[model samples]
Target: MHAPSQNREFLGVGWRFPLQVTPNGRIAQARHEQRIEEAIVIILSTAPGERPMLPEFGCGIHNTLFAPNDSRTIALVVHQVRQALTRYEARIDVLDVHAENNLDAPNLLLIRINYRVRETNAIGNLVYPFYIREGR
Candidate 1:
């Protein structure tokens, strides 16, 4: 196998989100692009003040958890996501952020994020599902 480039090394590796342990007794790690993607998910999933040491280090979208599934709410979510990623993930340049309603699951909001890896210029996208209403 080829060796990872310096840029890829700069991307860094970290323990996988949810903190899984491998069979060999080591923490599962996410590398390079996968690491960046996981970081994005973590940022979006966490709310400000959720991390005691880093009180302001998360997306503000969680504040709208009970917001109506309407255009105004969607716009706010998009803005929050863009702002959060821009602030936290210095490795990426956010290209676009948009949200769509899940017709079959009315309470679900599907958020799509398009970004470019700054070091390698690689393009990536991730879809994060946000639940606006609790299921019955």
Candidate 2:
């Protein structure tokens, strides 16, 4: 059997999203599952056309920014999340995507995604807070 670290090699290693520099003056990196999670975040957080070279990249959820807080809008957000992850993150298989309104914050929507790592069959989930309305 391969070592724990070696077994996770298929998940890949990459620079952390938002780009950080370590105290040692080296670029920060994410490995294995952490790298996959961060990739999902980057895919979902970015809007289409936001990247100059990759205009088609990113989730479509940004289009719902002005959409009303209702079942229809929630469904759209779920769809966007699923579509983006399926298209951008090749390391995992998307199992489900759902969204709920934050009780204390009317403008906030909590998006939950359940996924399984394709190579290792490891299951994971992430809850991303999306703001449909800009804070005043």
Candidate 3:
């Protein structure tokens, strides 16, 4: 069943994803901490020019896929991610942003974010997967 949109502003934290209407006829929205988490996903997933009226609203990591993954490049990425989140998401206070390689996942760069929910002061962390492939 599609979840119904409670268009009304909710004071809670977690909710369903995809923000789509289910087969039952309802809109999915994030609620508690999940709401904050999902917002991060949306921000990082969005590429510049993808959102109407918010042309500068994405992490733009995808465009940097081919850059050499050296120390300098990685530092730049961390800065960009931090800047994008700081600019677009007002719900969380970013404490730290780190980029590290996942030994098990050679093709991905894990972006770790430590942040606090501004409303509740609840601290949390999220690891966003950034794909990386060796250029031929």
After superposition on all CA atoms, what RMSD does each candidate show versus the true structure? 3.2, 2.4, 6.4
lDDT of 1 by residue, 20-81 (tens): 99999999998999999999999999999999999999999999888888889999999999
Instruction: Estimate TM-scores for all models.
Output: 0.91, 0.90, 0.79
- lDDT order, best first, reads 1, 2, 3
Q: Write the per-residue lDDT of candidate 2 for residues 30-86, one digit (tens) a residue.
A: 989999999999999899999999999999999999887778999999998998999
Q: How many collisions per candidate?
A: 0, 0, 11
What TM-score does prediction 1 earn?
0.91
What C-alpha lDDT values do all the predictions have?
Answer: 0.92, 0.90, 0.78
User: Which scores greater on TM-score, model 1 or model 3?
Assistant: 1
- Enumerate residue pairs that collide in model 1: none
Q: Give candidate 2's error at residue 55 in angstroms.
A: 1.1
Residues 1-136 of candidate 3: C-alpha lDDT, one tens digit per residue: 4322333234354446665776888776667678778888888898899988988888878677877665766788799889989998887899999998766876678899999877667788999988877575
Best by lDDT: 1
By TM-score, is 1 or 2 better? Answer: 1
Q: Which candidate number maximizes TM-score? A: 1
Model 2 misplaced stretches (Cα beyond 4 Å): 1-6, 134-136
